[model samples]
Structures are given as C-alpha cells and as structure tokens.
Target: MGKILITPRGYAKYGDEAGKRLEELGYELNVNRSGLPLSREQFVESAKEATGIIVGVDECDEALLKQCKDLKAIVKFGVGVDNIDLDAAKALDISVGRCVGTNSNAVAEYTIGLMFAASRHIVAAGCDVRSGGWKKPTGVELYGKTVGIIGFGNIGKHVARIANGIGMKVLVYDVFDIKQEDLDTYNAKSTNVEDIIVNSDFITLHVPLNDETKNMISTKEFRQMKKSACVINAARGGVVDEKALYEALKNGDIFASASDVFTSEPPERTDWVNELIAMDNFILTPHIGSRSEESEINTVNKATDIMIELLENHD
Candidate 1:
C-alpha cells in the first residue's frame, strides 16, 4: 500500500468521504492529528516515508523536499501554491498541483464580509454588546461607495460582481491583461494601483504572494489612501505590510482595516500585532477565508483527485 501524508486540520475535519475514497485506492493516510501545522522536524520525518503529500498553508521548501526521499507529489489543498517551492519540486521531479477554483467563491464572499465588518464596525460592536456596553457606533454604508480591487483573478472577479450587486463602483488592477468586456460586464473599470489606493472608499486585495506582490501595500500606499478608506486583505498575508498597517491605524491614515491572512498564522503576538488587535479600527480573522463547510469538502475532493492522478501516473 502507498503512503500519503495529509496536513491541514480543516481538511481532516471535513474529509471523511474523501478519505474513504483514498483508502479504497490502497493508500494508507498519515494525517496530522494535531490542530497545528506540522513542525519542520515532524514534516520531514513523516514525509520521508510518504509517496505524496496533501498540504495546506505550511511551508514546503527545497530543503524539506530534498529530505522526503519517497515523495512524488505535493498536491496543494487550496489554490495558491505560494507556500510550496514550485521550482524546487520541478527540479526534484516531484509533481505539484493545486485545487484551483475550489475556494474562490468562499474567499470572495469572505472578503465582502470583511469589508462589511470593517465599514460597519460589526465585530467591535458585537464585542461591546457582550462586554455589557450598549453604545451604538455609527457605521458607514457600502452603497454608492467606490471599491478598488487589486489582482483581478477568480476571487477578485467574484468580489467585483458582489460589489456591483450592492451598487458600488468597482475599480480593478491586475498585472495581467483584464479584458475590457469583462470589466464592462461587472461595471468595473481597469485602473492602476495608485488610482485604486487614492480614490477607493474600500480597497480589497486578492493577489498571490510573489516577488512583485510581497509588501505590495506598505507605508506609502497607506498614506495615499483616503483617511476614511477601509482596506481588506483575504489574500496572502505578506501582500500587506503589517508594520505599515499598524502605523496607518495608529496614525489614522486609514479609517479601518481587516485581514483574514497574516504574515504569520495565528500571528506571533508581536507588539505590533497585539497593538493592531487592541485598536477598535482593526480586525483580524484566523485565516478562514476559504473555510466554509461546502468549500472545505470541495477542496478535499479535488486535492484527493490530484493526489490519485499523480501517484498513479508517476513513473
């Protein structure tokens, strides 16, 4: 029987049906029972004996890939493969794939929810109610507001559609070409990042983490935004500089911000992160952007299919 190492607790929580399919294929699964990502030592040790790995946001670097002698595939449980070293895997002859479009709607919807949460102070107000306070915080409506979307991929497109549905004007930016017809369909205009940062009442990010996008939103970008602008990031954490974000919130450069992704998962509780957490204008979620019940199961099934295909076709 072949061995497959599975990380990502969310998958394990919702993967019983998918799991049975893998078992039927004669693959013995070694899933991470710990709710946390596997530590480097644990990953290398366990992955060394496995023919394939189903991974989440955990780092899969060249060094780890070199040590996993039996590995033939690294199938991403989600769309972005930023956490995995694609070039290293290719050079090492390990097939790598992602469950594309599996979680786009879930994440896009979460992005819209974050925008609402920030614009309406929904989370902070809820906290106050639970803490025995009844102060009604005045919040802004999303209608008739201008929303700027960075990275016009699947998630971004979904966000644009939702924003349009709510009577918001959409401005989009992408490094690649965005067809003008598609923009017209969403009632969105193709624009530059600077225009988005300066003019948008709400700015949302849905880009991959790469050389061009790392720290894409920083001190300068925050300064360029309207003082009442709310920023949302449901994309990779590194795309927005946390330090700059803290400063922006502290100095009132921006009215409010929310993130579902952080540079560090479950953030390390650094002084900046702690301060951001304490501020009423900031919101943080534990990376549940693509974690709706429906999406998780969909991701697991697609990831399973990829793993099966790779293992069966491997020479």
Candidate 2:
C-alpha cells in the first residue's frame, strides 16, 4: 500500500506533473480520480493507513482529522491553511505547511481581470451584443483611482504592482506588519481600514479568513464606501460578509462586486448565491484564481516537498 493516499483531485488541472513528482520521490502515491472530493467516510477509510496527505483547501475538520491515526504530516497546496484543523494538527503533532509565494501573481492577475469584467460589464455586454443589443457600456477606468488591499502579504504586494501598472494608486491596511520599504517601492500608501474603505475606487481583499478577518467587511464597512466604489474578494471566503455585500449592491450603496471564493462550497440554494446570480453588477468565479498551470506545479511541488521532508527524515 502507498504510504500516502493523496486525497482525490489533488491536481485536477495537472495530474501528469503531480504523478511525476511522486514518482521521483520513490514513494507510493495514489491518484484521486473520484471526479469529486472524497467523502468523509471515504477520506477516513482511504487515509487511515497513510503517513501523509497533500491537501487542498477543502475541509480537514475535527471528525476528519480524528480518523487518521497514521497521519504524520499534511502539506497544503496553497497559502490558506484554514481548511486544516490546526489545533488538532498541533495536538496530534502533525506538521502542516503551504505554498506561499507560488501563486500570488496568478491570483493578483485574476483579481484585476475580475475588476475589468465587472466594471465594463464584460460578460453581460458580450451576451447583450450577441443578442442584438447595441448598448456600448460606459465602464469605469482604473487610472487615477485608488485600489485598497486588505492584506500586505505576497499576493497583496503583487496586486499592488499590477494595479499600479494600470495607473491605479495602491492603499494597503493590515493588522500584521506592513513594511515602509515595500510601501515606498510600490509607491503605495499604508493606513487603517477606514482610509481604505473611504478612498479606494476599487477594494480588493487579499487577507486570510480567520477569526479577526471573518466578516471584516460588512454592512457598516460597505456603508462607508463611496457610492461609485466596488469590491473584489480573491482571497479566502468569509473575509467579507456575503449578506452585507449583497445588501450593499442591492441597495445601490456600492457600484458592484466580485468574488472567487464563497462562504459555502457548491452553495445549495442560499439567499446570497441567488442574489448574486440575479445581480448584473456581481461577478463570481468558482475559486479558480490559483489553478493556473505554473501555480499548480508550484503548489504540488510545495506539498510533495513537505511530505518528502517528513516521510524521509521525521517519520
């Protein structure tokens, strides 16, 4: 049996590369081809005998973590470690690590694209024009506007560079450290959340979704934004309250919004999902910001590296 039973769809977009990496590691690796995420029972059964797992940002919750007696380490594919039950991992001595800088540029680029798609009504306009509606929409421009970034990490910095390239001023606010040199290099301004909310023409969230950031942008924050301002969330879900965002856009408090992540995965007939789909001002992607070819390779390498490090030395 393979010492590692990688959860299915570990690299849904690039399976061949993942296979090669595991082959080179000289350890048994199983490919997950279930066409869906492993069911919890399936997860428990499959991983019960494994020494390590390379996981995505799916749920690695308490009940799921408890079944893995042989699990020595978990290597996350991307930056967000929220899926893993960290407290449980710590208690079980399961070392966890993620790919940090690997996919930042990809996500940054996607966020900017989402901004254009939303501002210009790209999707809506294309469909309209194809259907014989000659409404050449007047879209907002990025030049001479402020772009607010919630987090000042790798992804946030890259977003600053891209947004600045389009002549957009960058403003950042983080509870964590924001270096002055980085601010100077990017010609970005660093301040509190209020300044970002009030001044930004476009607000793009790059922060992790944790206790402090959960629902950080809500009705009150939305009310603070300019009537013409909009928001983009390419980071983790739950960083902004979906209900509040819906209300903000629905009530015309803000111009528009877009998000790659949602509070629920495969959302089942929720009010928020319904509202967003109904609104032409909203753009939603099924969490594909970091699944580019290069990023997938980077994430797989990071996950495999973690597994190799633990399996050969620690275990």
Candidate 3:
C-alpha cells in the first residue's frame, strides 16, 4: 500500500469521506491540511514518494515531475490539466486522468451568474448599499442579445442551453467543426472568432489554456469588440491577456467584464489583479466556477476512484 497525495484544499474542506475510503482500501493518504494550495517545496517533498496524486490547481511541471521518482499517476480533480506537464508525464511513464464532465453544469451555471452580475452591476450596487449610499445603475437586458461562445465543449453546450432559455441569440466558435444537430438544438449559429469578437453583445470564453489558446483574446480583439459589449472569462485566464484587459476596462473599450479565473491564484496585492478588483465595471471571483456541492462530491469521488484503479489494478 503506497501513499496517495491529495493536494487540493477543497478536498479536505469537503469532509474526509474520500480519505476514509482510501484508508479502508489500505492506501496511505497524504492530505494537504494547509487550507490553501501547497507551496512548491511542500508539494515536491510530499509527492516525491507518492504512488499517485490527486491534484487541483497546483503545478506539476517537468522539473517537479522528474523529482517524484515513485510517482505512478496524476489524476486531476477537474478537467483542466494545463498546470500539469503532459509531455513530461508521458516521458516519465506516468498515467494521467481527469474527472471530466463532473463540474460542467456547476461551471456553466456560474458563468451565467457572472454575466448577470456584470451586465446589471449587481455586486457594485450591493457594495454601495452596504456603504450607506443609494445609487441605481443602468443595465442592459440579456434577452434577445447576441452571446458569442468561444468553445463548444460540454460546458459550452450547457451554457448555450441556458442562454437559449433566456431568449439569447447564440453564436458559437471552436477549432473543430460543430455538428449541425448541436447548432439546431441550441438554436445557435456557427461562426468564426472575428464575427463573435466584433458583433456579439456578450462574449464568453470556455476554452482551455494551451499554446494555441494563450492570449487568444488580447489588445486587438478587445479593440475590435463593440463598445457596449461585455466580456466573460469563466474558463482559463491566459486565454485573455490581463494587462490588455486592465487597459480595456480602464478606457471603457467594453462596458463591463467578469472572470472566475485569473493568471495567478490568490493574486498578489501588487499585481494588476488588485486594480481590476477595484473597478466597479470589473467582477472577479476566486476561481469558484466548479465549487457547487454537487460538483465537489462528483469530482472528488471520481478522482478517488481513478487513483484506486491506477494504484490497485494497474498491470
């Protein structure tokens, strides 16, 4: 029975059912109790002897993976693996897996919430009321507005369903071809990125972070967007350049924007994130896209099952 490193703080916070199950199956649990992502040194030291790892947002770069001599597998608690070095994992003969679709609905629902919060200035209005001021903010209606979706995956499809229910006109784009049936199902139109960028009333991103998608929306895309448009990034952070986003919001290139993900987690006080946090037109959440009770149970259980299978049933 080898050790399994559980590095997500959320896992520990969600109670110890997964850990208890692992223990009953005779696998040693090395759980992170720090209530936050482990520092790099702490992560490497703990994972060096682990047979498998259940990770969240913690980075598992090539250099870090090479030091884990006893590591056999890395199973992501969520779908994204941008923090993990897949090439290095392959070279090291390590198996990698993810809890796919476990958080799709949760994240999709969150994206919609962010859209309403940004479009209507809900958060800002609440803050003003808390501070003993009464100010009504003018907002746009979502009904009958064109919403551009940048990716057409599970989460993207879920978003489209919700948007359609709200009477929104949906325009979708993806690197791969979107089936005509899916377009018909959602009453969406298949379009290119430029059409979405320039013409959409609301633009939402749902792509992963990779070489091809990094900074996919930057200064030029921001400049091309309608002055009344609102941008939403419930997906990855690197897909939109932070510096350019800061400038866009400051100059009112877009009416408002919101994001649940950032280039850095727990962004430093000295970072541009702090500036964005101060703006009434910019809404930032602490990466809580998939934090619903249902999603947490599904993702943690799936991740634990994968770890057990990899460690106990591997040939």
Candidate 4:
C-alpha cells in the first residue's frame, strides 16, 4: 500500500506501462540512487520502506530480505532469479515472480544471429567497409556444421529448430535427455556433454546460473573443444570463464566467441577480455537478451498483473 522500489536503470523500459496501471492502485516509485547493481546493505536500506520491489540483478540475499520487513513481493526484471534468495523471501512472506518463456524466441534468434555473425566476422566486415577497405573477410559456413546446444530448454530447443532449418546438424547436451518426439521434429541428436563439446562446430549455452553451472565451461572444458570450434553464450554469465575464454581465443584454441552476458553486469573491458575483442574472434553484447520492446512490455505487464491480482483478491 505504501510504494514500490525500482532498482538499477531499466524500470521505464520494462515496467513503465505496468507502472501506469499500478498508479491507479496508489503506488509511489523509488529508484536506487546507485546507477548499477546494489550491494546487500544498500539494497536493504533503500527498499526497507516499500511493500514491493521491481528488481534487476541486484543482490537480494537473506540479509537484505531480513531488513525489508514490510516487503510484500518482488518482480525480477528478467527470467533468471539467481540474484534473489527465494527461501528467505518465502519465509518472510514475500511473493516472488519472474517473466518465464517471455523472451525465449527473441533470445534464440539472437543466438543464431550471433553464430552467423561470428563465423562470418560480420562485425569486422562492417568496420572494414566503414574504414574504406575492400578486403573481403573469410567467414565460415553454418550449413553442414555440427551445432552443440547445451541445455535444451525452450530457448535451446528453439535454437535447434532454426539451426536445423538452416541445414546445420543439431546435437543437444542436457542433463535430462531430449524427448524422442522433440529429437525427431527438429532432427536433433541427443548426446553427452563431453561428446558435444568435442564434436560441436559451434556451442551455445541456455541454462540457469547456479552451483552446478558456475564456471562450468573453464580450462578443462576448453581443452575438450576442437581447436576450430566456436562458443556462444546468451545465457547467464560465468557459465564460460571469460578469462579462460580469452586465453583460448588468444592461443587460437577456439575459433571465436559471442557472449551476451558477463560475470559483471556492466562488464568492464578488462585487458585480457579486450584482447579477444581486438581480435575478430570475440563478440560482446550488453545483456540485451530480452530487450525487444514487445518482450519488455510483456515482462512488466505479466509481473505487475499477477501482483495486482494477488493484492486485490485476498478471498
């Protein structure tokens, strides 16, 4: 009944429409003064007075939740809730929400686009044309290539379908097996992670960020990949060790990489990471996996609409 706290810099993009509706419910909005992710103490102090919060990648651990006594709900800006401590929120009687399957297709499309962009060095070609150079960049072909899709959920499955349509053979590596129906429909093959990594011409990740996955693709895994294989990560950061990835790229162990997320949200241009960028082998995007205008509006609408339903109908 008091107010809602919005964190980081993207409220208007994701929540402004829903905010208009919430205004009719008499909610004031407070934004984090910090321009980036909030530390636990900082998040708690700023959000303690609010009944609800719209968050983006800020730390919402048990300590922060404990301080926010009046908190009623949390609306994560995107699909991944790795930043929020759900157990504590539940114990504290706060309802937690996220936009699931909202941007799967958009992200899947971006993944394939990145693969093409990397194999063809599209970014470098644009720069070459801009610089008045006529040198045609040699780019690899995706057709007939074996694409290893790690974590075949909605996004990964969609990626496989598109890749198959483009004449690429899809090999999926999921903890769970790919269903026979799905494998047949998309003409994808299910295999173990080791085989997929060793065999894939291009590898893209689609999974959550958590214990079993943090630094999941590191030095050992890099060693398993073909020297000519490339990597794509539009999923959460830290899945591939950026440092190791840089080393691999620098040493020509892997052919190229395209990453949409980073270990750091506003990921800095570290010297090693920049080295990869300087070479044509690496492509970096600022976590805009779900930034489609339609996706943004739908994410906000879905989150706020659910809260509105819960708030107005206690019966």
Please give the RMSD of candidate 4 to the true structure: 2.8
C-alpha TM-scores of all predictions: 0.95, 0.93, 0.95, 0.89
Query: In model 1, what are the clashing residue pairs, if there are any?
Result: none
Tens digits of per-residue lDDT for model 4, 26-96: 98877665556676676777788888888877788888889887888887877899989999988888888
Which scores higher on lDDT, 2 or 3? 3
Could you tell me how far off, in angstroms, the CA of residue 281 lies in candidate 1 after the best superposition? 0.4
The C-alpha stretches of model 4 lying farther than 4 A from their native spots are 8-11, 14-17, 30-45, 309-315
- Choose 1 or 2, whichever is better by lDDT: 1
Q: How many Å off is the CA of 90 in candidate 2?
A: 1.0
Give lDDT tens digits, candidate 3, residues 1-315: 788999987788773888888899887898898886788888889889898999988889999999998899999999999989999999998889999899999999999999999999999999999999899999999999999999999999999999999999999999999999999998999999999999999999999999899999999999999999999999987888978999999998989999998887766677576888899999989899999999998888899888878776554
| Cα lDDT computed for each candidate against the true fold | 0.91, 0.82, 0.91, 0.84
In terms of lDDT, the best-performing candidate is: 1
Winning model by TM-score: 1
Backbone clashes counted, model 1 = 0
lDDT of 4: 0.84
Residues 1-315 of candidate 1 have per-residue lDDT tens digits of 679899988777988788888899898999998887788788888888988999987789998899888899999999889889999999999999899888999999999999999999999999999999987999999999999999898889999999999999999999999998898888999999999999999999988999999999999999999999999999989999999999999999999999998988879998878989988889999889999988888899999999989888888
Task: Kindly list the per-residue Cα lDDT of model 2 for residues 1-315, writing each as its tens digit.
Answer: 256767636465565676676677665665577768777777777777777877775578777778888788787778898989999988887777777898998999999999889888897788788989978878898888889998988988999998888999889988887788999988898999999998888999998889999999999999999999989999978998988898899899999898898888755667767977678788878899986888877777777777777666654
Superposed by TM-score, candidate 1 places the C-alpha of residue 195 at a distance from the truth, in angstroms, of 1.0
lDDT of 2: 0.82
- Scored against the true structure, residue 94 in model 3 reaches a CA lDDT of 85
Position 16, candidate 3: lDDT: 89
Error of 3 at 122 (Å): 0.7
